[model samples]
Target: MTESTAPETGTPSGATGNRKPTPNGTTPEPVDTSATETSAAEPTAAATTADGASVETGEAGTAAATTPPRKRAARSPRTTTSRARSTANPSNETPAPDAAGEPSASAEQPGSVSIPQARHAAPDEVDSAAPADVEDAPGDTVDGDEVGSAATPVQGGGGVVDDGAERPVVLRLTDVVKTFPGVRALDGVQLEVRAGEVHCLLGQNGAGKSTLIKVLSGAHQPDSGVVEWLGEQVRFANPQAANKAGIATIYQELDLVDDLSIGENAFLGHEPKVAGFVKRGTINRRTREILTRLGHGEIAPNRMVRTLPAAGKQVVSMARALSHEARLIIMDEPSAVLAHDEVENLFRIIRELTAQGIAVIYISHRLEEIREIGDRVTVLKDGRTTAASLPARTTPTRDLVSRMTGRSIEYVFPTRVNAPTEPEELLRVEGLGRAGEFDDISLTVGKGEIVGIAGLVGSGRSELLETIFGARQPEQGRIYVKGKALRPGAVGAAVRAGLGMAPEERKAQALLLGEPIYRNMTLSTFSKIAKFGFTDTGKEREEAMKVADQLELRPRDVRRPVRTLSGGNQQKVVVGRWLLGDTDLLLLDEPTRGVDVGARAELYQVIHALAAQGVGVLLVSSEVPEVLGLSDRVLVMREGRMVRHARAEELDEETVLDLVMAGSLMEGAPA
Candidate 1:
């Protein structure tokens, strides 16, 4: 049978540093193609896929003589028509047979049509969209110089690209410009994400990466430029429309409801229903399958989201995306909350997804992670794209860093120092026990000593930290600050006893997010800032500004609300609040959880400076390198047990992993 004629889109160009800028409302000239390339003006009444499967558009054509079109079934008002993409190359894989309960055409028929996977009832009907057809619309242009160092990342070449032929670009945004009252959030940004690639988005906190994803996710409509999705011109009305279009976005802050069960959250707006009633069993069963496929079968579908840990919650978020059958999933900082083992699991899942030909947009600040998982890289600075679609593994760290920060970052971690051997003991836990969380967790932090806890996601590191801070009462144990006993289950008591804690969940557990930065910072020493029983706003701001200055917090304005700050700056606010106090012992839980590499170095320096000032620091971090580099001592925990205690300099990453996984103390190590 002869192939049907259809629109053929031009090749999407990448942003380079030395290329001349493209004019507004226009795109660069189409890429040069061979004479054999199909022309864009060809017309047809059927959809031809990269896999060679054909979709009969609801139109009459030459084949209409013997091949009658399938009956158009009644669709719900909310139902959207499934979109068809242009073909990359003819696939031998059969397009799924006509779906059940809709329409059917026998295999012997001449014009059998394949239904779009999303619109079909059968789960197997979907294939990662045939290379989406491209649409040429006027858009932004960037300096078009090719990069030489894109292949250097140690962790992130997403998958094997077609060495024979590169995968077709599935999504492209040309000259996309979005603006607000005083800010142009996306200034002529250009991006191209190829099918089956882990395209990473990198930038400093204020960079337009978030805005760009929001545009792609349909949360924000671009004020200018063309957004070609799956190779078609589309303006998503909202996030729902984007999801319907096979573009799923997993935000850094998950959008799942805590009150909902795992399955309910997974299929929130699109629940399986029978006669308008939700089929709870069906949704749960399907969710279970998806979770299992992602290598997390232990997460029960009936479990409430509020009860899950950070990593578990992340998995639930991913499960939701898979449930949507997303073809191109945008993951924003997906590994920020994951432990080492959990990250490995995430990479494994990503690998599995890509092997099935599903593309992923992975965002992370960890350079090593980008090396391991990303196939290509796009760096955003301010509101524009600086470097676009560079090979992920081959890109050197210096180039990536220079692009993100607009300056070269010489170091990712601060200089390490050994604590004085004769330092005073500032904090001690005596048989601290939290039932079902952590047991007999006893540790001590000497003044000027940084004690780090290394553990997997469910290893009770956070719970123990909260317990020591008096946020949770231990079933059997006591907490002491400089040998002074703290009242059980009392945060105020802990604060009064000279113990301050920067919790793991910065947005929820710490900080008055909605309050002004100065107000939040002054919370720790409100009484000290009071003038003879009368609160003084001026005095409060003055003291808060002093600490904020020392932290070098950006914007340098304490009047702005804490919620307006970036993740790194937000963490600084938490630590800065403690900095305004007379703290003897500080407990930091995942201090650099969502911070970028540049900010992580700054935060490490702050912690060290504090410890050097005779303040004891007890910190928990999932990154073994971070724990080892910043700590004077290391405590390894696994499944609620403090299994090993060793000097930081004495234990390497491998040994720490061994102790954590085996849940046993090393030979000749402190019990």
Candidate 2:
């Protein structure tokens, strides 16, 4: 299921769903035009019948209406009545009479309506938006000259745009400003999205991308500046209002109801009804249709959402958006939870959505994805627009990195120090096996040496780390610290052996959110500070303050609750706990998972300093770059097996991805 590596024109050919590639390497041509083929068929516009009831066609508007007219149905609460008519079918011809000399049922009742596919316009005819003399809003000013001045919209890839016409602008923000009590989350942010295009939003974790998305999704109101949707200024009062206004957002942490069925979750807020009673048959049928278009027809509508896999959950989220007839969907870290092959499927679905004239604002940290699926780019830094509407494909990596970090450093790893000729083996694992999780895991970490593991979420990366730390019992094999065997399933034994672990879910697994940072830092070594059955708070704070200074934790306040600290500082406290314990070996799982770019650099130095002091480090991270850049040796895992082992300098990102996704490629294709 890997995308073609061969070059093609327009957007990447791998992004073109339901299209057949010609052998000559020319632009691919659409081969399937059936209604079920979402990328190839045009979305049908709803027509008002004589009785004033609206009717929508099945896929591509090919189905003949069969349902008879009943009582007038109440409008769906989640959808607005006023819609901008699609230019795709400007002239709606009346249905012809049947053999009985009467008009078809479609002439009497209309079905559900979807936002029409956008019509592409010539570049010269496109409006660049606002005159240069327009004054900026207060607090900050968006550089008007950079707005759409450098962007030449990529063409001939997203559905109807293959003819070289540029899609119309659907969402625009100019000098948008949003502020919290103590932080300015958004300052003079500028962004523009066009119908039938994927606009990528790039930034570091704390760079205000989340706040901007909340503003666009109507979860928060902008303090100043303007937001225009479909050529008119609008401020959505709440999330529901934005949903009704053809906007939807899918966050990284999914909002799906676990107990509900697939069909129920898809239509939870706005169920089709008559006489105040929901139509269960209608909900099931409509949901099935949407799933089929997404290339997952085998998924039963009655299946419980909790039973589905991560990729399945993502598809259901997209189905929910289409159910709302959303014209613009904001996806925050959509691919973060997906496996390699599943990501290809997601790109395919996105191609179909853009083909149907839906605008998408995709937010992700992976820079490689921007080149694969994005048409235009907008970079945000420090709550302000650093650059707006740049070409996603041709922009240099150095330029994008400099924009997001305000510096030239990328991957930001501290220089690796060479080990002694005969390194001291600090820890070792001998064929450790955990049934149903991981098997035959064998590795070693030497004094002052760093080893890294690269894998997907379910590839047993976290499980292996936890098992080594004695948090889980292994069914077979053995673990050793300094050539001594460790007792299986014993946390106390592992700790006494000088093994320290910083888990992946630090908030849920590592930190005591309600307690003071000093208390948490002293958790592993409280016995040393306690005298005569009474704890010494003064000594505890003194010990915590020393590590805080070394790690350069923000505010350096040991007495403040850990929850009050930012994500980066909270992680520092977890690492600091081990430091106070005088641990010889450290195991880190996703150490930089939520830390921002600036704080990440600081944490890297802390880790390097620890290794320089003769501590052995073994780390696991989903990001291949992090694994390779920060370690001397790398191991690739897939489906509970160690597939490849090599030095960090011998492996690249693509090679590691291939090793992790080997078995996934042979899985059955969607539908």
Candidate 3:
């Protein structure tokens, strides 16, 4: 598990002697203006004074510090001099300044002030204050002019203050502007990151976080703006160029070769070579080392990446970054596929990287993670920097959320008004078991009901859905559709029995990536598309047009390739295909996995409309809130057994978490 320290609240001891007397007769010597100026200039110095060990900058700036050259860890702290250098040189590769501005003799004593050790705790257990401190440390020593005059104290907590000593700026963006066909994705945006800091970019799906990263990583070139590296201005022509320049990016859907071994995937296209042949032994050794740094030392490098758990695959992605000697890492929604424990592991790796003078840029939708891991924050609204930089310590999660959604977010999951009706059981399974996957899974879906199945990754949620869909036949179960027995392992039989499934993997198993929208939409309902044994292309287009209009597919182009559409729109196409089949029972696994928030809201509406139409919907999702919010009833599963079934209204996140942690919900089963 990743360990994080708490945010310090007491006034810094270094500023004690610098305080002056107030007009009200109170002595206030703790506000040292001279020290701030001196410290601000020496951004890369590691100064340990009689008062405390004060590293001036955050992680982004720490790259300039004179640390031993070694593999980087995510959460390492920075020194005072490092912070000063970062502020001075906002570019990508600017080097550290000379020793003249380094730590003074008086501040180098070990017995002067004792520095606090960072606490090791789980991501959830780490106090919110820790993340806040990380965010505040960066701009604490900036000139008064740079500090926004209209700053307000964040509510629900005491304000966070920088100690003005030990913080690093891990990443900095200046006047970054990017333009799309008809929209400016990013406009003169400036962002800064500190080492050992989790800096969050808060914005709605299209608020330009992805665009900004794309520009930084060289996937998209900005129309205007200079990207600075370390302390020097630099531009990348492509992702490979940025990667070679020491920037590694992990996207929402990982870019890993599933067919390759973990070691091969970790070193894809850059495998170690001795002479003319690929050096498998060298690659495996390096892979093991990188995985060890990520705190997963036990996973064999020779194992196929596809066979690993989803969270494990994510770790492998990180390992790939480490293999490239990445100094600046950008992670987009890394937690989307991770469980509670895996997230903790990711945090640990972040801390370790920072310790080694590496910087990280983390983008995620989980506001709680922002509050837990973020050191600083940048809020983007409509492609503009609404909030240039906010100290994570002092910023409220609600305010950050407001900036992202353009409105106050009281709850993530909107409450559902209706309950499941007991009209009749639409589908039933008894002792459903798949060898080496899950066993003894039995559940029922009622007519017009939304039943949610919840479990951790590798706990058989997707497998169970597959079994019912006939993609994978259960070895020892009886499936009854409307009280009629059905043969196993026959997808045609299941489809004929009024059952339809949207598989977990939408890109590979669900949609025909190369096919046009109209054809892909009609592919599932070929029977309906035929007239007198001849396929009716005209009728198919009509049907496709109707569903496309209903789902708000962009451009209204039925002939466009499914791959050409955005993730959300493509998902709509997939779902529309199953819906067009007129199947009575719908099994959806991770229906909205890759779709953005706006599209997710649209999907919710569709789901409600489906339930209103009396189609039994079995919704399976890894995101707990999605499962809870959309379902009429939720069935908790663990180790392949049905643990508990509860009405959605009677359950909350905490209760669901408890059931997940307990591994079985049989004790809390609804009476």
Candidate 4:
């Protein structure tokens, strides 16, 4: 509840009105006039309007005014510079509302959020005043109120939460524009990243996020705009130049050499040298130190990069960035490949990095992650920043979604359909066992039922799915479809028995990336579309077009290469392939692995629709919540064994995680 003041005589000092003389007859302080500070420590206070309104910020940074003589300066501009910069420029990123509740032209800047300026005060800044001196430290208190600094929990790990507004901007982009042959990939993009803060970049695929990152990483140059590092404007000629200037980009597809050792990968291009000789010992020692700092000391520097898991590879990437002494590390979907516990560990590393005054540009499609680890957010849509520097935790999900997709969306799973009382079993695995991969797994998926498998990365989830699909020969198992046994090691036999699988690695296993979408979608039924042993392109495209419309494939073009589509669309094509065949049981491994929220919702609806049509669905997912929400029944896998099986309604995310993480020891507890 906000504390509001009743109306009083004379202009209220801090009530969105012109300031009147203090009750004690002291004049209001004069506004400072100076340039913005890039590295100076500024005071922390609750954000207020220039005319002294108590802007109470809430979800999505929506602001409401309150009556008060002194308003907290929440989201205030960098404390390193006083209110001087805003006064001198009058367009310092924060939008002010007019009588009509629209942003006044004088207060609005490019990429500025149109919402009223209701900046939320950090916990320590609730009762604080602006720093009285520019030279004061960030932790300095003012008028008995702790300001600009707070420590909070991130994904169950505690870390200092620095007030980003109080920190000096280390990287700034002004009206950055870039264009491809026929596309404007970035248009007048503006971003300001402060030191010691996680500035999250939010956008849907094709929203210019990739282009923006490319521009920042020196892979592409902006046709027009300013790129300022620290304080000086500089244009990098290539990725190496950017790295040399303390900027590192860790892309979703890590660029480490597989054959190289961890230490060698960490310092690939610029290995430590002494008198014109590469210092292998020095490189190993420093790599070990970096790994230790990242909380992964168990990984030996001499270990081959190819031997590391996805999470371990990510740690090596970070180590490589640190090896270059990067001040700002750009992470693109760093958590996409990580499991639950691995995601927590990643957040811990990010917090530690921020505490050391290193800035981070985090790009991800997961909104919950933005709330957990982000300090501020800049949203992009259609090659432009829709909103810049909004409070990450306070911003409503609807607001962010609207900015990214140009419309509000409720991210919800489809309504569950009740399974028939006497539904026929569509698929059954009796005593399924794959030596070293899985053991003694028995489960049944009834027609119109969705059965989900939940497990860790190495808990044999993917391997089990593949084995059931006949991609791998099981050491011992009886797989049946609609009561008929399937050949042990024949994918063709599995398909003939009405089984279709969308593998986890879609590009590598499911779809031919270089092939057109229609061709890829009709791969399973090409024989039906052939005439005299020749492929019928027209028939294949017509069949694919029907599925495309059902799936709502973007651009509605079937001739484009499968690789050109987004992650979600690629998965759709893979699933659509099964729709062409007489597939009664569908197997999905990480179906929504890299899909955005909007696409994920659509896919959920598709799955539900398939189940409603009496097609059995079986899937494996790293996200426990997804499994619980989408599945009718859940199976927990751990250490190559089936540990628990229950209806989805009888399980929750935490319970599932507990079983997956500690099920081996809890095997004796209960199913």
Candidate 5:
């Protein structure tokens, strides 16, 4: 909220209205200045207007609202300068967003959220909404107070009890801009989020949505800009300040501590400790209540975080936010790791949160999820606001997608080829049984065949893929690549036998994130590229570059670190690593899991091209549609069993869903 006293006659002090006040505490001077010139862009943050109002220009490094120049000196009190320097300059690499709402390159960020002092306290009405959505909205501003200022609980899938009237503005920004050396991450972006609303932030990869959120989260100080939290112009210096201010961020790469217990992670920064000892019982009980409230009472608070499934980890992450007494929660690709039913559960929780007047900033590439879960929508294109005030449910998908990618997208798959009827067998798995994980799973892939597996999260689909990759030994099974049998539990043996796998968890199980592209790519092929018992770096690069080129890797620089690339590009690097070897049979588990639509299309083309070259591909995806679209043959798994098998053309997503859920489709063979 702009808080300035009205002048008795002329422009107010620090108004920037026809008066530029020099830093020297000059006499009440009236130097001529025009708001029109400032309209193009606000003045640099270093220059504060005379009327006690500081002009902040962008998201990064800027104070929240212009603070009294004296108060601004203490900005980001907890932010370590050394840490900032390391993150700001990533070894000559460009700093980018971590999650969709993830932080840009930064040193180790201190945990900010505190343990909930009042575990079951309802949020105060004075401040119960999201962070800022800025200016340049023209006339589409929804007066939030016209709607429900007091957000209370409502029942069912009906979104927050917004009676379709304008909501009270919780956060507002004007002409937010952030720039890097060669790129402007935010180009005068404008947005607004009202109380009790689900403001969906939409954009393709590299679109400023992440950057904007980071600025709001206080992880990245904006270059210059005005950040209005609640009704007062304010600036958050660090993530801790944002958290203390009632904003919670759940990044895409979930910042949970896998080594800790559920309760421990929930109260990491602000544990219930006294006399140097934590109150474990209190923390566990509170964590249990939070999980139960989230409809996940089954997840024990004492359980190790590493033991949980992707969905379970997500719940833990949310539990941490709840522990913070967050008024608004920022979810970055929250659904990426979830399966079909899990997504529904997530939506239920989201609705419940919003009903309590807690605003949610949802960032995702899936338009379908947006329609199902979002309220007001804002689209970011090339670091600028392309569209705001759009209705999530009513906006045409093509319009939303076109705005995101700057091109119309057709939900099309690469055409599958009808390979020779008598194709050579590339892989054969017979009586594959991994104690308790999967049993008697027999499958075959012929040359040029794209085989897909569809299953629930715990149906052992990923386990089967792991066994084939030699990450896990099968108790009773034979895996044959071409005609050679692979030794069980031997990654090297599998690699030597012309087999390759891009695992389900790419970040954890596939790529060495911080390694250079060439190193990560040629790691499995060092022997092939070695000369005189010495690793010939030149040969390694030549081989890695060949596969990198084949995949059309962006930037075309093999020396770049893998961590700096986007999710889609990172997946490509993982796939390209395998391409450097004699890989006739490729195993792809959730190949396009976190990739964007534009890059998803590119990945699909890469898969098709590999198949065209007679590479037998075995794929697995929780998304039934992806399996139905990309595979020639489909195998549905239920529990530890293969429930159904059919040609992709003969099945649909509905049938596959039924098979995974009930172990049989309407008229298909039963498990």
Candidate 6:
């Protein structure tokens, strides 16, 4: 014999009653008695026919249950007259359907529409059409595809979610709403995170992904909503409050002080102290332990962050978060500055955190990482949830990208057209070496050709560009432009020789963020815009507008501040500056690093167009796919030396990785 618990039902239990209490504790009754009689008198529509098909309804109140699923029953001409009456007033009477109760599922099945999966009904009282306000009681079984039980609360002290449970809620956001002037950045956004899960927030720019992170980190506050921590509702007035609550956010622009030592930067605000003074020795000891755990024992705690390489500096930032005992860490584009090996190290650390029951909120534009580290994903678009709580193992990348961009993109990289043949050599470098940075680099780029420079981070790719562009003086080498020898460290000579570079650090070395687009576009060609030591504003504006139009700059107003534009648009302005100068050689370093997908496609088109115009292009990027797809010829560099040169057709990711790992052509010389 089976023992069963009594089903909990309200006052009108198991009765086909005229009046029932709504889920929100209100009685909703039909105002007109005639409408109720009309609905019941009509024959009951088929719930589901044989072969799981549905019946069709017509204006004559006739139900055709035998209609095929592919074709709908023809509606009588009276349908238009019936629709007209219905449009005039919406009533409780069941609306007339053109064909079937289920509508046409054929068109939706093969397309982007999401179909619900089947699940077993609960053992308790079941409602086929449950009301919205009816909250499920604790331990009540729900449809697996529709609803899930609330996450298990955190167990550890200090509000940090413990790792012992099978599933633990690390972060909870309810009804989060944020607004900016005329824009509602986020409206009623809801999210739940579990310990040990890598939750990816997938969205395009301005999709409220960044805005949601801001609110969680206390950088912005929702005008309305309750932020719950470990099942307890709490309000974070500032980032410090969130930090103290064990939430650490690592933004794309790392907030570490470059001038300070690694240990000092890691423990900036909360330094180890003894009595009244900072304990330098104690801090250094603890710093070494953290770095060693992160597989970077070689990173000196005393070294200034500015002096270290880009990859090392990124690791230092991660160390800072770990030092704070961050239980829920948010990484925004953490791999943007990292090389392949450094990215591997970061994944190792992330895995270690998950093992310890910590949650990671990873936000990245790189789809490959989402496949590797993400356990679950949430996609947002236009400040609303397009998809929520999708398992990474079951979801396809194409689906995620479609949800994020709101368009079906067959390919991310644009098609490359044939570049010019028999182009002239615009710039040449021989034995270009910057001591300690890179060494013995030699390459030449011809006009109307795109030459790609590929290497792992810290391999001196950026240094080579700087050396050739006169930003950094090469200790030993000669640079020639159009067969003319150029002096090292002389910007005037480089620019006069018809060479221009869009530096890797766009904000620092390329554009004056505070300046207007027109000023930045003409900044490189100031001498041409000046006549007899007098600046010509008219010529500057005219030149700037021309390039802006060429790059498809929106607004087309050259006077707007560059800082106001998106990252992709700003990069275009920087590239436009050099293009306007009509430089014989163009050096672009990481041109699409932080740009969104749509903008990246546009930028690639611009780059190819520039190459077709006979502008010798030197492209430096860490993304192997970008180099392989965009360049006519690829040059792999390591330790400041040109290691391998191959045609784009001959180079694959494996071959490039082998070349990068081999570390220089000198190693391949007949030994």
Best-performing candidate as measured by TM-score:
2
The TM-scores, one per candidate, come to: 0.72, 0.75, 0.70, 0.74, 0.73, 0.68
Query: In angstroms, what RMSD does candidate 3 have relative to the true structure?
Result: 14.0
lDDT for every model? 0.65, 0.66, 0.61, 0.67, 0.64, 0.62
What would the per-residue lDDT of candidate 5 be over residues 437-468, giving only the tens digit for each residue?
Answer: 88888888988888899888888999999899
**Least lDDT summed over 10 consecutive residues: which range in candidate 5?**
81-90
The candidate that achieves the highest lDDT relative to the unseen native structure: 4
**Candidate 6: where are CA atoms >4 Å away?**
1-166, 187-190, 257-325, 407-411, 430-441, 473-480, 483-489, 530-542, 554-557, 663-671
Compared with the true structure, what per-residue lDDT tens digits does model 6 show for residues 52-74? 22222222123212221111111
lDDT of 4 by residue, 1-671 (tens): 01111100111122223222332333233111122222212223334443222222223122212221121122221111000000000000111111111112335332121211222223332222221331333343334343344442221111343333345556777667787665676776777776667888876666677667767877667898766665445566666667755678887777777899999888887775668788899879878888877778788999999998888899998988777667789888888778767777788788767655677898887777776778777776666665666566655565566556543343344567676555788988888888888887888888888889988898998998889888899988698888989888889999999999999988788878778899999899998889999989999899999999999986578998776676777889999999989999999998987776556777888898899899999999877768888887888988888888887889877677778886453441122
What are the clashing pairs of model 6?
439-640
Q: Write the per-residue lDDT of candidate 1 for residues 227-268, one digit (tens) a residue.
A: 655544456656666675567877656767899899988888
Give residue 569's lDDT in candidate 5 (0 to 100). 76
Candidates by lDDT, descending order: 4, 2, 1, 5, 6, 3
Off by over 4 Å in 2: 1-160, 530-542, 555-561, 564-567, 594-596, 663-671
Clashes of each: 32, 5, 80, 11, 31, 1
Instruction: Rate residue 378 of model 5 by lDDT.
Output: 79
Off by over 4 Å in 1: 1-157, 257-325, 339-342, 406-409, 417-419, 439-442, 474-480, 483-490, 666-671
